[model samples]
Target: MSAAATTSQPRRPRSGNRRDEAARLAVLHAADDLLVEHGFGALTVEAIARRAGVAKQTIYRWWPSKVEILLDTLIEDSAKRIPVPADEPTAESVRGYLRGFARFLTRDPAGKVLLALLAEAQHDPDTARSLHERCLAPRRARERAMLTGATDAGEIAPTLGPDATMDALLGPIVYRALTGASIPRGLVDTLVDALLRPRAN
Candidate 1:
C-alpha cells in the first residue's frame, strides 16, 4: 500500500477512573491472549469479554468491534517493541530499525497479530481501511521522515521515491515473514547498505 493513506488514531475510551482503565487493559490483554490461543477465525467480542471478566457492553462502549481491540493492542505492543532510536547516525538508525522490525516479524506475538490482521484485511474492507489508516500509515510517515533526513544529510542517495523506498526496505522482510521463510542473518545489514549507504563521488 502507498503511504498516502491518512493516519487515524485508534479509538480510546473517554478519561475515566482507575477501574475503567483496569477494565480497558484487561480487555486489551484478553483480546491478545484469545487471538494467540484460538486464532482469528475463532475470536469474538464475547470471548474477549469472557476472558477479561467484563461484560460485553464494556467492550462495545470502548470499541465498536474486535478489530479495534486488536488494533489497539497491536499499536501499543509495537510501540514498546520497535521504538525509533534518536541521535544516531542515519545509517545506524536505519539498521537498528530494520533489525528490530525483523525480530518483531519473526519472534514477537504482536507480529502474529499483525499477520492475522493483514489476512483479514484482504477480504474485509473496513478492516483493511482501519489497518492502513491507523497502523501502517503512521509507521510509513515515521520511516519516510527518517529517510528524508538521511537524504538531506547526504548520507544516502535519494534515487527512490518515498513510497518506493519504503516498499524496497520493508517488502523483503515482510514477504519473508508472510511466506514463512526464515530471515537470514545479515539481511538487515544488507538492506541498509543497499538502501542507505552513502554514494561515493
Candidate 2:
C-alpha cells in the first residue's frame, strides 16, 4: 500500500530463465555429438538428453521437437567457426575466406552435417527460412561487400554486381558439394580468373 512497502517487496523476485537456457544449450550440444557419431537418422530426443546429462522433459520443454534441436545445434556450431574475415581490402580476401568456408564444410563432421541439414531444410519451410536468414544471407552479404569494395577500387571490373559476382565465384563450390563432384583442380584460380576477366559489355 505504501511506496516503502512496495520498494521492500523487491519486485517479487523476477523469475530467472537460466533453466530454460541451460536446457536449450544442453540439447544443442547433445545434438551435435549425437549427429556427428550416429547421423541425423539415428539421433533421438531421449538419446540426446541422455548424452547431454539432462532430462527428456527439459529438452521438450525448451525445443518442442528434435528438428528444432538439430537446427539450433547447427546454428551454434556454424556461428563459432565461419571464417569470413573481420577485415579484407579486396575481393581476393573474400575469395580466400570462402575457400576456408569450403574447407570447413569438407572437413570433419561439419560438411556432412550441413548437407544433411540442407536436405532436411528442403522439405521444412521453417527450417529452410531460418537457414537462409541465419546462415546464407550473412555470408553472402560479407562476400558481396568485399567484392563491391574491390570493384570500387578498380581491382575488379565495375560491371560485376554483387549477386552475379558471388554466383560466378561461389556457384562452382555449391555445384561441387551438391552434386558430389570434385572441386575443380583450380577452383579458386578459375573463379578469380572468371571474376577478373574483362566484361565484353
Candidate 3:
C-alpha cells in the first residue's frame, strides 16, 4: 500500500455538516477500538455510537454504515504509516514503502481491521466494492505511477509491467501477513534487488 506523506494528525470528517471535530474523532476512534476488541462480525453502528458517547444518528449523518467508518479509519491510518518518499530513487522508495507496509501489517491495529474487512468483502459485494474503490484503488494507482516512472527511466526492466511488478513486490509480504508468518529481515531488500534489477547499459 503506497501513500503520500501525511502527518499523524487526525483528519476531519468529510461527509457531514457537523463541524465538531471532537465528536468525529471519537466516533472514528471508537469504531476502530470496537472492531479490534470485538471483531468485525460483532461490530455495529450502535456499539460504535455507544462507545463514542454520540447518538446513532450522528454516526449515520457522518457515515452510512460501519464499513464506511472502518474504511475512513483505514485510509487515515495508512496515509500516516505507509508514505512514499518523494526525494528518493525508485528502488529506495519502493524499499521504504515495503518496509512500512510490512510493519503496518504486523504491528498496526488498522492492519488487523483490514484483514477483517477483506474477509467480510468476500461474502458481501458492497464491502468488496467499497474496499476496492476507497482503499485499494488509490494506493494501487500511486504504486503503479512510481513503478511506471522507474520503467520509463530505464531503472527497471522494460519487460516487467507495473501491475506485475507490484504483485511481485507486495505479494509475498501480503501472503505472510495473511498466514500469520513472520516476515524475515532483509526481505524488502531482497525483493527490491531482485525485482528492480537495473536495465543493462
lDDT of 3 by residue, 81-179 (tens): 886554434666667788989998888998877878888998999999999999988898888887777666665663468788888888898889888
| Candidate 1 regions with alpha-carbon error over 4 angstroms | 1-10, 86-89, 198-201
**lDDT at position 15, candidate 3:** 36
Listed per model in order, the count of residue pairs whose N, CA or C atoms clash below 3 Å is 0, 0, 0
* Per-residue lDDT of model 1, residues 1-201, tens digit only: 222221121356545568878988999999988898899999999999999999997687778889999999999999899975545347677778888898898898788789889989999999999999999999888778888777777667756886798798889998898888999868877877776674667
Clashes of 2: 0
Clashes of 3: 0
- Could you tell me how far off, in angstroms, the CA of residue 192 lies in candidate 3 after the best superposition? 1.9
Better of 1 and 2 by TM-score: 1
Q: In model 1, what lDDT does residue 201 have?
A: 75
Q: What is the lDDT of residue 44 in candidate 3?
A: 90
Off by over 4 Å in 3: 1-19, 86-88, 198-201
Model 2 — TM-score against the truth? 0.73
